[model samples]
Target: MDELEFRRQLYTNPRNRSEALLQEARRNNKNKKLYDDMQQLENKLEQALNVEVPDGLAERLMLRQSFDDSRQQYRRKSRWQIAIAASIAFALGLSTSLFHWQQQAADMGQLALQHVYEEMPYTSGVDEQPSLQTINAKLARYGASFEQLPGKVVYVNHCAYAGSPALHMVMKGKMGSNINVFVVPKSTELKTVQSFSDKTLHGMVEPLANASLVVVGEMKEPIEKTLHTLTAELNQAI
Candidate 1:
């Protein structure tokens, strides 16, 4: 597995003993060390959770189990109780793993990319553009608005960003390329333009007033120009 996938797996489940993962770990000294370190941490955590039984609890339990019927029924009940406890523990562990992974996977740029493409095919550019009022209502939630859009406002709706629903817009670019705008109310820790590109899409994240705008589209589009226009209009609105 690649480093990102390997690290994610390690973070989620250090106790995992998959042969393929073991082989991947063994391929490089650094990877092996990383795996070993994670495993060591897991061991230490498990050790920390180990508890000693009370001194007289074992003898009292033995006396209770001395009777034949009680012993047999208690044995059956003990098994069932242990089984249910293990199932619950397993579920809790799985849920914790998923939540941890989701927290680690919080990158709004990637979220914007996925949302943009997922809606691209099903929704086309402005057959009948959304009214400015509709767009502003959604944008207002984030303290941003479009008094006048830079381009045709083909689609406008709300989509999730970091588990919270935010404004989503699809605008037709000057080059006829469709631009996706995701405006989420957030305070970015860094104050710089973040750009991303892939085989089929490219985009940049622009920090805004109490929010961020993610603009994405095909490579040929004048993405930078669109961004400037959008930013200017948004600044005026604020």
Candidate 2:
């Protein structure tokens, strides 16, 4: 098998043990890496598909079977029904996993941008507006600190992002709009400058070693320039 054939087999049935495909994959460096990555995904899918069986489930299922002719007919249908239930469960699990994985891959920056406005309703609380000391204190937990902000700090609060605890804040921007900054610690972020936008909000995510610094503001605002200056100040403080 050539590289394409080997890859086709890997994609379709990564567990295949055909010597020809396996030999070709091992011999080609590129094919080996592709095979490994695909295999890892396949393994994850397999693990996700696995369902835990209740204790004595097999015994309970067998107990429902009997040898009578009329009962045997029903028994056959029961077995078929059980198989269908298992298949449906497996299909649902796979679909849910795939949905979340696909969502996480598509437009992470856009999600950060949306989060800013989504939390606006709760902005009126007395403690919602926090001081610079409070902001840097939260940052210091993730091995980062800011002696000064690019603009006036208008709001600061500890919020949740992607099901994890994160530091959420807002700063005054040049265009009379508040910039939302969500800092998430011990979370995954893109290791590059990723920009995202919507009709009302625009944002970027800067991946850091211990946290992700996400910034969002109005679409017409100077995002790149402001982010650069803010990041520089943050680095200096650190």
Candidate 3:
């Protein structure tokens, strides 16, 4: 298959392990790389979409609805008493089930990896290295500012992350590799983790007082060093 046809088939169904497509990919290094990248993206997308609902989510929702009904029927009860019960129920639901749901929905590492692949079609020709001032222009929206980056920047853009605006950046890594860094406001639903990884990439999440930094790099890249440098150099507006 030609490049266009190969890409078409690969994206349409990355799991198509037919011999014909496999042979085509094996014959062309570029096609093989593209095939692997698309498959990894598909896997991550599947993982993000297939999260199991908490064991008692429906029961909690029912309980919440029941609480609402009770409030309507017990008008004579002290307002504070009814309110307290409702609050307790809501908190219990969130603490047990909704919180897990949120964590799955806002899996920052998976989201970041997906974003990188989604932008792959456009990132190749990106040649501009944004200045620090230019980069901070976007970061300012999240109450964040970077004192300096650990390496040369290759790309920068604004993106939506976990239902909030985020600043996405790509920097140069060892041997001309690409490392992605995302600056997201603390207000966003995404809670940062210490580290995360997928088939082709791995990185760390640094949670600041008012914002979070998610740094992603190829599996072979020195991501920990970059994260250390970034945590030390990154400044947040208190």
Residue 135 shift from truth in candidate 3, angstroms: 1.1
Question: For model 1, how does the per-residue alpha-carbon lDDT over 8-84 read when each residue is reduced to its tens digit?
Answer: 55666788888878888998998899999998898898886564434434443343444556667866765655555
What ranges in model 2 sit over 4 Å off?
1-72, 75-83, 86-94, 105-107, 124-129, 186-193, 236-238
For 1-238, candidate 2 gives per-residue lDDT tens digits of 6443465457557888789878978897888887788879888988975766444344444455555568668656666666666667678987999887657644557557656666665442323456668878877766777767667776776665655567777777787677788776644443334777778888888876677778888888787777777777784223
User: RMSD, each candidate, Å?
Assistant: 15.7, 17.9, 13.5
| TM-score for candidate 1, residues paired by index | 0.57
Q: Assess each prediction's global lDDT (C-alpha) against the native.
A: 0.72, 0.68, 0.74
Per-residue error for 206 in candidate 3, Å, reads: 0.5
TM-score of each: 0.57, 0.57, 0.55
At residue 103, give the lDDT of candidate 1. Answer: 51
* Cα displacement (Å) at residue 205, model 3: 0.2
Quote the positional error of residue 112 for candidate 1 in Å. 1.1
Backbone clashes (count) for model 1 = 0
